[model samples]
Target: MGKSTGFMEYKRVDENSGAVKDRIKNFNEFHKHLNEDDRIKQAARCMDCGVPMCQAAIRLKGMVTGCPLHNLIPEWNDEIYQGHYEHALSRLLKTSNFPEFTGRVCPALCEKACICGTVEDAVTIHNNELFLIEKGFEEGYMKPRIPAIRSGKKVAVVGSGPSGLAVADQLNRRGHSVTVYERDDRIGGLLMYGIPNMKLQKEVIIRRQKLMEAEGVVFRTSVDVGVDIKAADLLKEYDAVVLSCGAKNPRPLAAADMKNTKGIYYAVDFLKSTTKAIIASGALLQDKVTLTNAKEGSYISAKDKNVVIVGGGDTGNDCVGTCIRHGASSVTQIEMMPCPPVERSASNPWPEWPKVLKTDYGQEEAIGVYGHDPRIYETTVKEVISKNGKILAVKTVKVKFDNGKLVEVPGTESTLKCDLLLIAAGFIGCQEYVAKDFGVALSKRNTVATSDPDVYTTGVKKVFTAGDMHRGQSLVVWAIAEGRACAKQVDEYLMGYSNM
Candidate 1:
């Protein structure tokens, strides 16, 4: 709990962001943090509500409404208010493994469920968190804490995403020998490549990876588990194996013949190419170096091209921003679902996840540069017009829901010039090859199946699964929570009981 009257006295102030005109020039973090005094004032906005729903992590109307990691928001806010930075960080780190990552990328579900937000703007929990973690690092309090004792248990974690990193961090902290495997050239799966650099700088991920390496965790990158190595070998080598490869199988457009089509790419692949190029060019380590100036032919360039993005989700939005940075001629986003209400409806009450329009940074940039919002709601791509195996344009049609079924309006069909088409339609589930190699049963949703939904153990003994690979595509906070839970299960299996 913070100062009892702080909520009434202090106003909410968020981190200042660079102007869209300037930020669009490079792929770097744009949000400028509030000074220490201002940040403390924001932390003081957390009221001493007897029941802090911000940390409740409850399910409402089929959607999770609060921090999935169950972060101790109130306690940390109070600590920050009291000027106890280290104490605040300790309490913060108790539940969350990577606050820095969540603080930047999380949609801040905790703020939506905040009791204070029911009447006014929510406390800057997300900003306060980022400040605390960054302060800890700046003040040299984020040093690695190598385990004092070893449990002699070995756990092999496949994947370096938040979930996999969480599992490795927890099990290693509990004195287990943990080795993380990643197929990519570097650590941090989604954080390293899937996400756009503007949202989260690659340096932040590299910093964390360095700290993790300083600890006992072993990371072996660029070694594909199912391909470069076999699951049976891991089973024989490690005491327990946890699959946290994540939901990476991109969903294809059901209506279009996208096969062998030029100028068409999956959103993640596009993002990865840009990230790889930036790293290779050393732009991340330099100041004032435009990220767009990365080595040519190393990445997909949206420069001077009319771009069409399918899907109105976060990935689609990211594509819009990346395209702008790439100096795209024009950009458009297509969403099959109808646009949400601008404000919360009566049915969508407080403490429940609000179903309202969210104009993210990418959309704002698109609007600023293009003079219009890039999203076209309730529309689907009807046909891919190609010439000589290359995409030329796309024919789209207006659609509406009838009896919960999508129906397209025949007369509303129209074609738009599209030199490059990016499919951000989201993922179906975890790629099946990894699950198949591990001999784990898959759920109907294509996630690794467990006898009990709450359990992490798979059909095969000594094999476990967590994160998107186990629960389907989800938030980073949820992935971290799942990883923590799975680590406990692995510990219990290795030892007679888990003290983790």
Candidate 2:
């Protein structure tokens, strides 16, 4: 309530992104932050309602709503409205350890739950958050807040993704020594490989890691816990162990045809290779790099190739953008589910997250270059056709849901010429190696089994699990929440009290 009538006077204004033509040329962040006055104006849109739903992480129809970290959005929005940037930042960090990461990558559950969004556009909470943290960093107000005392306890965090980082940060701040182990060469597990640099700059993650280092969090890279080291070794050497290894075992399409194609690849491998090339040589667009160990001889250049991406989610859209930027002749994305309505339906009411047709960053970039939306609704690949062990085309068919199962609709069969086939289906759960090695019982779904909601312990003693390992694949905010909550459980197990 900075200006009594500020909400009435101001319209929601988000930060402007860089021009698509220039941005897609390189793998880098392009979302420009709003200036001081502009950001305050945007923040003024928050009414700071009496019953702020944005702070409540509720669920409706089995889907999550509001901030998963349970951030005090209205409180911080009011702070930003009054031009209290530092205060807003302080309030933000109370729950979220990495606002910068969430600010860039999160789909913003808080915005959907904003009271202002019931009937109108929501407050620009996400943009304002980005502005506040970026300003904090630029003004030299951001630094590592090292713990004042040591509890003489050591904690081992398996995985360096959002959840693992959040757990280590909180545990370290609670006067415990924390060490994070990552299987990747870089510290960021998924952020380094699963995500593209253009959306979330790898440098942003590295910068945060440096701050955590100064705060006395030790990071070990390229060393797997279950393989290189043993789970029993960790339990004996460390006081507590928290697992945040993400759900990344991809679900493969069941097909009996068995084209045995060479060009068919998992979406994760493509994204990982693309990011590696970009980081290794500062090459992102159209440039070809050959891996010595590439089983498929020579790289499948997206340049002048007809590419069909099977899946219409963020990962599929990422492939679309990357291929277009890589000089693909044409691109098409197909989703098995029917296309969503352009607007929220009658069943969906205010203060609930609206699921509607919205163009994401990658889709927008693809449309800018390719002249049309690349997605095809209600379609799935029937079979991949290859010649001489090389992918050439794919047969697709329109599908309809019948009793919750996909059934092919007759007379809709079609063949799409495709030189490359990328399957962006989805993940199953956490990798089985570590969980099996530790003898920790997993749920039928393969996620680390937790007997209680808040308690993170598994069947194995002194072993705890969090993030995707426990909760399955989810948003970044959920990962952070799991990490924070999991650390509290670990604290209770070690010191006989849970101050964290």
Looking at candidate 2, the ten consecutive residues that score lowest on lDDT are 285-294
Output the TM-score of candidate 2.
0.95
For all predicted structures, in order, the TM-scores are 0.99, 0.95
* Per-residue alpha-carbon lDDT of candidate 1 for residues 333-438, written as tens digits (9 for 90 to 100): 9999989999999999988999999999999999999999999999999999999999999999999989988999879999999999999999999999999999
Q: What C-alpha RMSD separates each model from the true structure?
A: 1.0, 3.0
lDDT of 2 by residue, 65-167 (tens): 7888888777777788887878888998898888988888888888888877775688887887787788789877798898889999999999999999999
Please list the residue runs of candidate 2 whose C-alpha ends up more than 4 Å from where it truly belongs after superposition: 256-259, 282-301
lDDT of 1 at 214: 92
Residue 51, model 1: lDDT of: 91
Candidate 1 lands at a TM-score of 0.99
Relative to the true structure, candidate 1 has a C-alpha RMSD (angstroms) of: 1.0
